[model samples]
Target: MHVPDGFIDAPTSAVAGVVAAGALAVSLRGARRELDERTAPLAGLVAAFIFAVQMLNFPVAAGTSGHLLGGALAAILVGPYTGVLCVSVVLLMQGVLFADGGLTALGVNITDMAVTTTVVAYAVFRALLSVLPRRRRAVTVASFVAALVSVPAAACVFTLVYAIGGTTDVPIGKVATAMIGVHVLIGVGEAVITALTVSAVVAVRPDLVHGARGLRQRLKLRVDGELVDVPAAAEPVAARTSRRTLWVTGLVTSLVLAGFVSFYASSSPDGLEKVAHDKGIDAGARPHTASGSPLAGYGVKDVADARLSGGLAGVIGVGVTVVAGSTVFWAVRRRRGTDVSPASTAGTGV
Candidate 1:
């Protein structure tokens, strides 16, 4: 959920800012281990795709809609640390460029949407994987459950945060109930989106799906009544799709989703916005600082045609998010290389 400014007081927001910064710092380091030549670029595409899919809000209830939070999808496709960074990048772009999320509440949004969702979803995903059959379908199943849980988890976290620093006097219990209740319905949408997206990628390039890695069972051959592992070379190699092809395909899909398909998305308020309006949580909400930006509210300034303006804004958002995410991930990948370089380690005895 994109928490707007003034929903939380300055002190609580400041603390959240510190927490967000620390989490991001740790994720940056952890991402080095997750990103490599094959997946770094993919991670960027994941972020852009998340940004695109989020624009296509689906109706959840009479007045509430839901969109992809992306944490579960990202974590399943990439890794959790990188997933956090991916969603955070989308949040940053939305806040500064689209004026959707408030700048002052950036930390709150990141903590609630990015950090909490990624942590909870990834935990659930791995736990399920441990017990479920190690197959592609199992991975998709885990993704669905993980995504389903993650949305309510985020709602709970937001409720907790609001209880501590809420500007209004709304009863905490009521807020929690309403928030969780509505988001539970929203979670279904999240689960479907996450599962379908993960399943599609796993089908095309299981190697590219980080969570699905190592899912293939080893070949067993019985010789003299004893089972032996098959030689690696003896195994038939599956036809491979090039990473560039997948990347291009994903980018094109994102463009199509955001640039055109987004026009048909439900226009009703999202889960958080609906809850806030219903519960008087927005009584203290302040205008976004970037509200005056040309791309504010996901539309180009002075654009006569609604379709063209929104399309342009969506396309621009995808382009910027992909570039920014790619730059960050590539730099992290480079840093990883530098850290293991022989020249850098030559002077220091291991």
Candidate 2:
């Protein structure tokens, strides 16, 4: 959930900002090892897709809606470090451009949404993958389970944050129960979206999926009396297509979802909004600082047509997030290459 300004006191938000900054620093280094030629470009597209999908809020419970958090999907497709960065990019874009989340609560949103969900979901996904059969279907199943658990885990962590720095007087127990209950329903939607997205990518290009790496079925050979494990077969070179096709497909899909399909999203309040109203969590909420911007509230200013205004805002958001995310990842990848060149030269005495 995107915590609004004033929900948490200044000191706690500052602490959270420090924590988020530290995590981002560490993730940058880790991502250098994860981003490669095949996956680096897709990372930006993944972020843009997550932004678009988030705009399509699906109805969950009575008067409540939910959307894809994208942590699990991103982690499964790209690396966990990059996944965190991807979601952080989307949150930053939304806050600065559309005023969806508050500027002061950026750290809270990043900690609760980006860091917690990615870390928890990836951990669970790896653990399940270790125990389950190594197959495409198994990857999808693990993605589903990991996403389901991550949402509630983030919700619980948010409750803890509130208990420490809440600006309201509501009972912590009530808040916890309501947050967890509604988020559980939201988790199902998250799981379904994560599984489907992971499955689609894996089906088309398993090599591009970070979690699916080294997941091929092991070969078996007959020994003295029983079968023994052997190395897997090498993939055929002709089976692979240039990455341009995949990139174009993803971009088109994102454009369709945000430019058109988003118009049909439910108008009901999301899980967090409903809970905040019912549990008094928004008692101290302050107006977003960007409320006066032309594109504030996800509608273009001076645009009379509701559909056109919202559609333009969504498209712009997707475009901006993609460009920002891609620039960040490309720089990281180039730096990694630069770092490796020196080591190779030293090793070769060149």
Candidate 3:
């Protein structure tokens, strides 16, 4: 849920901002360990995909609806540190470009949505992977469970934030119940999308999915009634082919979701909006600073046709997000490369 400007006071907002900043700083370093050529690009695509899917909100209850939060998806697809950066990038874009999330509440949104969701989802994913059979199915199952939990965890985090900074007098318990309840439904959708996406990636490019990296079971041969594991070179060349093909496929799918499928998404308010309207939680909400921008509501300013306006917005958002995310990730990767260079390591390896 996007917390608007007036929802949280300056003091609380500042605290959230500091926390978010610290988390982001830590993610920057963690991402260095996570990013490689293949995964770096995927990180950017994950952000773009999250930005795209968020445009397609589906109705849930009377006034509430749900959309992809992308924390688990990103973590499963890329890695947790990079996943946090991905969702944070999407939040940043929505706040600055589309006027969706409030500028003043950016930190709150990042902390509750980005930090909490990524941490919880990744933790669940890793824990599940550790216990379950290290097969493709296990990765998918872990992705589903992680995604399912991440949403409700985010809802709880939001309730806590609201409890601390909310301008309204509503009971915290009610807010928590409503937030978690609706978000649980949203979590199901998140789990399905995440599992499907992660499965697809693991199928094509298991190496690309960080969570599935070591889960690839080595082929075994029975020799003298004993099974022996095969090494990488012994595998068929076709089996070890580069995943550029799958990367292209996933990228194409992301484009289709944003460029075409998004047009048919529901117009109803999402879970947060519905709950806020029903509970009078948004009574103190302030208009977004960019609400007056030409591209205010996910539609182009002067584009009269609703479909055309929204379509154009979605397309532009995808382009901008991809470019922005790619640039950031590429920079992170480059820094990592420099750090690992032989020249740089020469002096330290004595």
The C-alpha RMSD in Å for every predicted model, in order, reads 2.6, 2.4, 2.3
Deviation in angstroms for 148 in model 2? 0.6
Which run of 10 residues does model 2 get worst, by summed lDDT?
A: 231-240
Candidate 2 residue pairs in clash (backbone atoms < 3 Å): none
Error of 1 at 281 (Å): 0.4
Cα lDDT tens digits, model 3, 1-350, are 77778877788888999999999999999999999987898888889989988887776677667999988888878889999999999999989888987898999999988999999999999998888987889999999999999999999988998899888888999999989999999999888888988887777678778899878867899999999988867754335546666656556666777767888988788888888888998898898999987777888899998878888888888888988999999999999987886776787963
For candidate 1, give the lDDT of residue 311: 93
State the lDDT of candidate 2 residue by residue for 1-350, as single tens digits: 78889898888888888998888898899999999987899999999999999999999999999888888888889989999999999999999988888788899889989999999999999999999998878999999999999999999988998999999998999999999999999999999999998888877788889999878655577999999877555444225656888888998899889988999999888888899999989999999999898999888999999999989998998899899999999999998988886657786867
C-alpha RMSD between model 2 and the true structure: 2.4
Query: lDDT score of model 2?
Result: 0.90
Per-residue error for 60 in candidate 1, Å, reads 0.6
Better lDDT candidate (1, 3): 1
| Candidate 3 lDDT score relative to the true structure | 0.86
Model 3 segments beyond 4 Å from truth? 220-232, 236-243, 341-344, 347-350
- Please, what are the lDDT tens digits per residue for candidate 1 over residues 1-350? 78999889888898899999999999999999999999999999999999999999999889789898999998889999999999999999999999988798899999999999999999999999999988778999999999999999999999999999999999999999999999999999999999999988887788778899888545789999999988757754334777889899999999999999998999999989998999999999998999999999999999989999999999999999999999999999999998897876887995
